[model samples]
Target: MVSWLGHIRRISLTPGANQALLRKRGFPERDLHAKTSLEMAGGSFIEGFGVAAQSSTAAEATVTLARIDGIRRGFAFEGAAMAMAIRDALPLGHRRHVSDLLEAADDHIYMIHVGVGWSFARLPRPLRRAAAAGLTDPTLTWLALDGYGFHQAFFHTDKYVKRQYIDPDPPVPTNHHPEYAPHAIDQGIGRALWFVAGADPNRAVRLIEAFAPRRHEDLFAGLGLAATYAGGAPPEELAELAERAGRHRAALAQGSVFAAEARARAHIAQPHTETAVRAITGLRVTEAAAIATQSRPSGHTVDGQVAFEVWRRRIMRRWATDDTAADGAGAPSTSRQPSTSRQPDTDGVKDGS
Candidate 1:
């Protein structure tokens, strides 16, 4: 089954351009607050760009950001502005290391990414409520933040190969996106994705030069993008749990493309659920746990485990004990019972295809 991964666009600002970006993005003044507010609020780093999509199948996974209009607006903005924001926020000067700037900054830029949202116009009566409910999910917030994190990591880590990473810089001034062929325009999708990235028009050119569907595919294949997460873990155990939850999601996609497709459909319902719970509310293990309680519309069942569950179990494994009263073990398995959901065993796990 072919998966429809959305366009995952990442723009890393060239050094020394935060203030310019502030104005482009309409920040009142070049100040730390702009960066802080976005990160704190869990906003997408790239301004003006967003994603949209609608699917009829209950089991389908496709990238939503590819929502393209014949005329593009996001690319119309200047890359220099965003680059400047990153530059000013840092400790480094001309030719200074991006890591130095990030390390020296007040708060490390967490991450930036965007997930597709439901267009009220596109939604039917039923799914519309679900779309509106998704806004509050922490996992949704996590999805939005990743692109920023990816952009910054590349911006700071890579070293300059030649003055220009692209053989020739992008089309001057105007954005040149792909036409007939995909990878052609979105070359930046791969070019900027390398070891290091910065505020170079080449990256921008590579980014908008070709906007293709396959480019998004290339990004997912290149990095093996993991499951989306929303917020922080209170303890090491909780962090582990979140990772495990994401990994379980990843594992399902890996096992069978069909099963992965189904899970992808399920993801639309996930961000909101994970957020509604204040505490860990998933299976003990992503695979093992997800399978234990997975469910379907027809009332079918599948066992499952989640990244969050695995992480939690690793930490609690030593602490957890078997229940002698039920299974004849000494203590009770805290994981077998989830605090977040009503009926732990009622639903099938992520393994359900």
Candidate 2:
């Protein structure tokens, strides 16, 4: 059977093209699937810019960035930002030295790495290693690792790459996604933190906390996902990782559970749902599945995209409870009130589409 993403083929990455496509489709809910396919197609476009910038002279890279900047915003602002980031980082990345990429600031490297999310998978499967070589810089490792993780999770059914090493074992191929395309990307980004931190879950938590303190909770959800779906890690390790990821266990768990269900839904064969949950979160299969069921899309929440917004609120609320429990006085809540209806957080940062 054809995959969901296979249907649309590649769409134009130019802002005008996307705007026109959106208008032509009338931006209807039924077209959500097609819209997502086009959004991901931008990955190839952004990666091309990165590759072009590497081969071109500095003057050419500048020209490339300028051209990218002129394009209109499409499904997400990340596409443009990624192109720019790649343009800036190409000089260092072209050297094929991880240390050079690390010399650049974390923000620049991350934008470059995460921007390559889709292209990571687009590479001829045989060339993936050559493309990902020289990624040892710990400082910038998290983002590249996350981008690779996102690539693995988004395109493959299992964790085929471990610690900059791709398992010779091939992932079961199917046109399945664990969540909406954007959310799945986030989860992949988040999951990479675990591997980037040398597979130490607690270290991953600390890394996320230090790097993106403002967006830790949302990222923690992705960490939860990688731990769950990848398996093989000691269950206790994952459990400890979840605990250190702040007091947002419930919210983190919710994201992971929903992702598992989405993966199962997309696959033609039955998934080892319970086994994966127990391995990832130390939760029984039934309990984990229950959480997934609770997060089911409703009238207010449609699909994993909107569901993430609602789940994030739960994480904030759970954080408040943790703070209250830590101190006798209740912690001041910083989160917005749980909106019965709210749009996805598409700001193009940790929570962007």
- In order of appearance, the predictions have TM-scores of 0.21, 0.37
lDDT of 1 by residue, 114-203 (tens): 211112212243432232232232222222122322332234223212222221231111111111112221222232232221222123
Which stretches in model 1 have alpha-carbon errors above 4 Å?
Answer: 1-41, 45-118, 121-228, 236-294, 298-353
**lDDT values, one for every candidate:** 0.24, 0.40
Q: Lowest summed-lDDT stretch of 10 residues in model 2?
A: 69-78
Query: Candidate 2, residues 130-230: lDDT per residue as tens digits?
Result: 44443443222233334545556333423332222233332211112222334334455566554444445665666566543444455677776555543
Model 1 has a clash total of 60
lDDT of 2 at 127: 45
